[model samples]
Structure formats: C-alpha cells, structure tokens
Target: MEHALFDDLVQSLKEARAIAHGQMPASRRIKVTAPDAKAVREQIGLSQSEFAQLMRVSVKTLQNWEQGRRHPTGPAAALLRIVQSAPDVVRKTLHA
Candidate 1:
C-alpha cells in the first residue's frame, strides 16, 4: 500500500512537471480584465475621496489605480468588477 501511494505521488509530480513545461495543454484558461477604476468612479458620480472611502483604500492607492500607475488585486479587484457590472446594486449594498 505504501509503495502504491508513493507511485501515485510520483505520477502526480510527473504530470505537474509536464504541465509546467507545456508538454500538457491546460484544460482551460480564465481571462479576467481588470476594471477601469477611474471610469467606475466617474460612472458612480463619486469624487476621488468618496470613491476611495467606499472602496476602503487610501486616496493615494485609488489615485494610483486611476492614473494606471498601479493596479488593484485580490478582493479590491473583485469588488471593482462588481461595481462596474452593477453600480446601483453595489451602491445600495455598500450604502445600506
């Protein structure tokens, strides 16, 4: 049983190496377009300070995003996408 488990582990590692080296094609690729932070803010009719406050980011960070000097990632990026898709829903949810 122990030998079987080791064999399975070795097979898994080999598959992983193949995938890493592009010997195996990935099943699918997900493409996520980063939101246009400045456009989102303008569409919502919020000033930079207000938008920054609502997004829970520092003004400088928001400015960076707006200016394309930096990009938002992780949860912040996710939230911005949500806002872009459903501005009213996000506004109601956040303001509520």
Candidate 2:
C-alpha cells in the first residue's frame, strides 16, 4: 500500500539523518559538566592566588570559570573535577 511505502521511506530518512549526525540510535554527544570552580577552590583550602598557583593557571582564568564567564574545556575541565574530588591525584598527575 502507498501508506506502508511512505512509512518505510520516512523511517529510512530518519535512519539516514541519525547516521549523518553520528548518533548511535539513542546516545547524545558528550557534554563536559563542571562543578563550581570557586567552591572547588575553597574545598581545596586555597585562596584565589594559591589555587591558581596550584592549578598553574592564572587567577583570572579561575575567576572566569567561577563566574561562568567561560567554562573549562577538555583536559582542563577533567582536571578541575579531579582536583575537586581527589586533590592528591591532581598533584601527582601534574607533578608526574
């Protein structure tokens, strides 16, 4: 029937679109979710200057992250979270 044929065509188009967009049927692209940078810094028991020193980034960068003026991306974002949960791990990784 024409209705059945149209349904098949629509399904095929959807499959093609999903493939073009690199979706795996139901998976979405990974978004890096970061915590409150200021809170993370505080938890590590460091002032802005001290934390920036430990992170090896400028204090302005830390301020931007905390204020959400910019978000950390890629390895920096990953390391920020690691620094939040396991500071020793960050220290070891950085020094290593």
What does candidate 2's lDDT look like per residue over 10-90, in tens digits?
Answer: 998898798788784644567677778899998878899988887888999989998989988877787788898899788
What TM-score does structure 2 among the candidates reach?
Answer: 0.62
Provide TM-scores for the models: 0.66, 0.62
In the predicted model 1, the residue pairs found to clash are: none
| lDDT for each candidate structure | 0.90, 0.84
lDDT for model 1, please. Answer: 0.90
lDDT of 2: 0.84
Residue 24 lDDT in candidate 1:
97
**Considering only N, C-alpha and C atoms within 3 Å, which residue pairs clash in candidate 2?**
none
33, model 1: CA deviation in Å? 3.0
Model 1 residue runs over 4 Å out of place are 1-31
Worst 10 residues of 1 by lDDT: 25-34
Worst 10-residue lDDT window, candidate 2: 24-33
